[model samples]
Target: MSSIPVGKGIPVDHVVDNTAEHPGERAPLVLNMHEFNDVTTTVCRVAESRRVPMAWYVAFVFSLGLLGFLGFCIAYLFATGVGVWGLNNPVMWAFDITNFVFWVGIGHAGTLISAILFLFRQKWRTGINRFAEAMTIFAVICAGIFPGIHVGRVWVIYWVFPIPNQMEMWPQFRSPLLWDVFAVSTYFTVSLLFWYTGMVPDLATLRDRARGKIRQIGYGLFALGWRGSNRHWHRYERAYLLLAALSTPLVLSVHSVVSFDFAVSQLPGWHTTIFPPYFVAGAIFSGFAMVVTLAVPARELFGLKDLITLRHLDNMNKIILVTGSMVGYAYSIEFFIAWYSGAMYEKFAFLNRAFGQYWWAYFIMVSCNVITPQLFWFKRIRTSIWGMFILSLIVNIGMWFERFVIIVSSLANDFLPTSWDVFIPTWVDIGTMIGSFGLFMTLFLLFCRYLPMIAMAEVKAVMPEADPHHDDHASDAKDEEGGANS
Candidate 1:
């Protein structure tokens, strides 16, 4: 194997020996890294550098423009009321709700990567977990915006809370809509805490290495005085494990509750026992795709290809395949259940989704969410950088259409044919949806620029050098000492 200098005087194979001779041996999770300090240097260099990449500036400016457009759309909605959206009489929920659910699903992969994989001891997660976690925070932020603005009375939004009011009215506790508030809010709070807590060590590294007083103080404040002492490491591990445990249930529950927004409703298409699990699967499906979508450009743009390797991309693609299959199965079963029930309303709901006015949307959803991911069955596609990246984008687009088909199609043409109407999204609706992507990218790019994009401490833990047995000097010394004693 070819060697690389991980640190001064520390030389090791950048890529582990996984040739035909070592069939049982595992490949390294972190390439181009063998020393613990090298991991720190590799990750921290991006945040500490003064020369900004032109790609970052270009992306930032474009995202900022979208964010500004989002602000304008929201402001216009406030002034003109919800009528500005393409929402019609029966289709009261359209792009706003679709975007809300889409963003919520986008957030799920982060917690799954950080918490679930951590619990299961999936070491490959070290490369992508921090990125995914940050994505979760930003995505949930985008998701939260819709619920606040979708309600026509934006000023009276506080009424959703249980605070005492002059009218002596409290929020309807039994409402599924109210449950969403608790579920999403709790998920965001826990996720934010988990993301920040994991960053504490890396933040401290940045704090210590920061060139200026302002940077040191900024990173130090959030680092919470994290010293690399035995006691500090102990507490950090304990806290991280606890937060991971706490976050595990949120991954399944948050989206399940989000599904409850539709499942609990009396509408034929909306009411179903399958939505909870189905939504959870689709959430993970879309979430992982979003992670890959970000990871591809991120790895390329930031010169992190060595840290975020093809193996990481391949593993994530495998997951996208699994969840995409689940989503496909859910789609098939929904149609089957509709047929088996012999309920005309349910039957029409499923048939209308495919043959109705919005059939094009349904086609796009199935094509993107189901057929696109199936291509990953080929090893060549999964390993190909451009192939997986394009597929991931397609999956995200399909997932968004999935939400659109579920909400708009069902609501647009309900049991009462007299009330049926075609829901056409106005420019405002399209722009707002586009603008949420702007908001997500804006937050994510800032995170990449200022913060440690990868977890320094965690990445080191997965390196070959972390194992005491892997040190040649220690082994050689032990052998020499044994010979002398003998």
Candidate 2:
């Protein structure tokens, strides 16, 4: 196959044709793309197209229903009381805290992919980073809700903050709960800024391509006067780099601090040195799984298979496998530590998790979080889109259960057997949990409809034509065009 010319007016059809001819060849990260403009066109087409996919409408309607249901649940919760939940004497923290931790963990993969991978100069991140970043923001939004409302007295929720008032009330500085307020809020702020900063160049592209006044103004306002000049590019790169570096530590620290909510407790299962790393690993594990969950459907629905190719999915699966292994190891080590500490209470706690009244939840957690991911070791499974998609869903379910097992089990069967009782969730608990998913999907679907899903500028930067010598090829093509015109 002769090298395809890189310059404008050089037809790129042969590039796709040649790629098709060689079926077994290593696939390009951005498949079916030879021209720089193709990346912009392919991505922008989704947002700019007049006719939306029927599936998107179906999904949007479904998501809206769930969002409305979430609103209803919140209204009821606020109107009634915290007693509407399944919170008992032993299990004061049930679905609310469980959902909070689960959503927070869900947001982790976005930062890890956006910040950590960016700092490492991983090019594969380009195809999916926008999705992950959006997910991080939405997931954090969902995560933030539970903490605010979980307290019975929603009116006094401001007490969680360090703000002073006429009464001279101050938040408990040493409390892990208060730390969550700072950590989650800070993480959300940085993630939101990081997400928007990266979208500016792409927003400018949309502004330029807009055929209507509203689109031009809407996209233009957010584009921040991006002119694609050398100075603009330089400043954008510098700011993006700084934000990426800033976001990297938060990926580890945010989740680790979240783990402190449990680890700092003196309860048998909750108190442990391993919770920090263990929680971080599980967060990434579940986070990447969610990216897969969202990516598979979005790519399929939006005709983005060429951009978010199988290689990207496969790479994400490998990360899931690695992190899932770490999670499984953490589970085992928890039990080992319990035995090694020479404490009967700790041993009982570990044993109780595996073989207690809530044994079903633990089994599901292990099976979904631990055993299911092991299937990715097979190349066939991870490479198959549906296989990985299904596995990703299972992994997320297991992660939720993992949080449930950690919180509910530990709290339910504590020191005194007489005080121990099973916590049964009300209809409100189940509805609220499902409603959060609705809220996440609804925000994500709206983003897909309006914003550029793929990072057009970043994707183009990674293309072969972006290489330095590609300009020489363009010069040759230009000379050929000049001769033909003459």
Candidate 3:
């Protein structure tokens, strides 16, 4: 248990022997338990602080206003009917469907960042995984709300599912809408479980550290008596691994199923086989952009620069670039195939998307998603806080426009020329879309204020000092030198 001298060159065998005797010795000899504990304490201290800024209050107020707008829109829609929006005969699925797909696509980035990156052993994810996972859950909640209300009666929305009824009328499994019901519902459930499971250990850390009675009770109950015991850690690790594996496929499949709602149909632009991968890529692309948009500000606001470092931002930016490129590729392929296939309807769909009524929307999408993300190849741009923040916002805007272009342009001009008509969204349509943003921000702000946005324990686990090999390297180097000398 004897400690190594501070400055002297201790024999490599001596260091190794001591490390074997006391596994928690300081670096160069063993793991630095003290440093790990100190880092964890510092993170928790910052996270638990009760001070709220004036900006947070302003944001909360604005969010409430948006929520009020949502309430008004819903009430109007219920009283007046779905006719309040711009859904006409041909363009039956307009802004409502577009918004649903847009939000659902936005939700994909969170799970991809947390689960997919975790599976790849990306240590930087530890910094923002908790926040990203929370974003996934909240975004899904936002996404789920649209489709629920999109079906005029809202009350009859539950009929999409199979329930115990005397009539024995089961939802048609063959319908894409029914598939959407199952896909979105399953995604929400799995994401919530994944998010909550990750939070349990962190909640326990908060519970043990909390001073206030309310915090103690709240965090304690959520922690489920997690004590970081070896037994519990063993089980927790296995469960987490299983959940991540399960979620990865769900992330891909849920959005693919969603895309099927458009792709499986005989609509000129919608019938392409590439829709599944294309939609999933677009979803991840936009989702990552949204994650960056929110995370960059939250990390700065919460003074979490050290925990959510430049490394984490760089990784997220890289994802955005890759996915954006994939989406761009899909767009090009779609156009090429449309022309090469010699399908008159398909050719017209692509040409119409570019030069049609919604030409501006198509250009906005290309510029925002395809062109802007190309900047990420430069390390300086991706790592620069302001550069990334601006790019991320642009990406979100572009992705939204992409959906607008796809849904509106395709439906506005179908097979029959006599039936062709341009679709325009009413103020109510725009209001509700903006209101969903309000809901998402409101929930996010609450999360930042109350919960530990950064996963403290997980971050600590990934720190350099926590690596058993980090210090052992020095000893190993010395051992080789000693062998040479002998």
Candidate 4:
């Protein structure tokens, strides 16, 4: 391993092993300390620049417009009724729940990257964890909107909460629907805490580097008095580790509860034992796809290829392949289980999903989620920016259609012919979903503009300089001490 300098006053021999360079000429994760600091300054300078970049302004404007439209849609829905959404008999949970599940699934990647990877001591996570966690927060916000408004009378939306109301009702504990409410909300709260808590040191870095007092105080307040003191870092590391541990199970539980919303139901296509792990795997797949989809452009826009690195993108693509294959395996198992059980409804539901009126959706899901991702098995595709972006989008599309197939197909023509009806989403359904995209982009754009998308301090911590092995001053002290003390 190559020797590297470490944190302030830390001895050379005490350096961590994680900072060791790869054998046989692997490229460095970062260039040099000056270059690393320059990258940090460049990110902050984007926030401080008096002139907003033209491209960013255009995107932000469009996102804000969509948000306005979303607001209008909600107001109109409240004034009119749920009738605006095209939801009808047997298909009450159409686009609304579909969007809800999709966004929630998108959020899992962030927490998984930040928490699970941290626990495993994956050093590469420092490059993208901040960006991914921010995405998680925004994605959850987008997700929460669907369920909140799907209640129709938006005024009474609070009824979902277990508040002792005028009606004296507690939310049903047995219903997975109720469990979903708790799961998603808990996920959001913890994610937000974890995201913000992780940002403090980076925020202080910005605060210290701020050119103007306005920027200084603004970053300072968010920095929460972080001063890079050894004691402060000690507590910070402990807290961060604790949060990471707590967040892992919380992240896992959110999607598991979401799957239970379907698995607990007696409906043939919906009810299945495999749904928990299946949903969690699919969530991570879609989440990584979304991250790749966002990061490829971001690395270009922010001029951050050195920090984000091709290796990061390559690793993420590998995950996408793994999880996408898991999802496909679940699909096959569902089919086999349906056949093996000899239950007519289950069997019919499985056949109908692949060959019934909604066969197009099922096939689309298969193509997008399963077939397209198989391209990444080739190193050429995984490393290509354009290839990653296009395939990521395709995966996202397929996952959405996967949910559509499950939600609409099963309900549209179930065993009970009397209750069966084809579910069709209205203009509101389409618009609202579009608006959710708008909302997601809006938050992300603002985050990129104002916050350190990469965790600066965390990145520094992993840099070669922070490894005491490279600090000759510290190394000499140890040698001298050994000779003198002996």
Top candidate by lDDT: 2
In model 1, what are the clashing residue pairs, if there are any? none
Give candidate 2 misplaced runs (Cα > 4 Å).
1-4, 7-27, 471-486
After TM-score superposition, the amount by which residue 159's alpha carbon in candidate 2 deviates from its true location, in angstroms, is 1.5
Model 4 lDDT on a 0 to 1 scale = 0.85
Please write out the lDDT profile of model 4 over residues 229-278, one tens digit for every residue.
Answer: 99988998999999999999998899999999999998889999999999
Cα lDDT of all candidates, in order? Answer: 0.88, 0.89, 0.81, 0.85
Select the stronger candidate by TM-score from 1 and 3.
1
**Residue-level error in angstroms, candidate 3, position 122:** 1.4
- Compared with the true structure, what per-residue lDDT tens digits does model 2 show for residues 1-486? 336564563443444322222232323567666767778888999999999999999999999999999999999999999988989999999999999999999999999989999888887799899989999999999999999899989998888887887689898889997888899999999999999999988999999999999999999999999889988789889999999999989889999999999999999999999999999999999999999999999999888987887778888999999999999999999999999999988999999999999999999999999999999999889888889999999999999999999999999999999999999999999999999999999999999999999998988887657766665655454322211010
What is the Cα-based TM-score of model 2? Answer: 0.93
Local error of candidate 4 at residue 395 (angstroms): 0.8
Query: How well does each candidate superpose onto the true structure, as a TM-score?
Result: 0.94, 0.93, 0.90, 0.92
Error of 3 at 118 (Å): 1.7
Candidate 3 lDDT at 374 equals 100
Ranking 2 against 3 by lDDT, winner: 2
Q: For candidate 1, lDDT tens digit of each residue in 192-236?
A: 999998998889999999989999899999999988898878988
> lDDT tens digits, residues 217-311, model 3?
99999999999998988998899999999999999999999999999899999999999999999999998898899888877776666566565
- Which 10 successive residues of model 2 have the least lDDT summed? 477-486
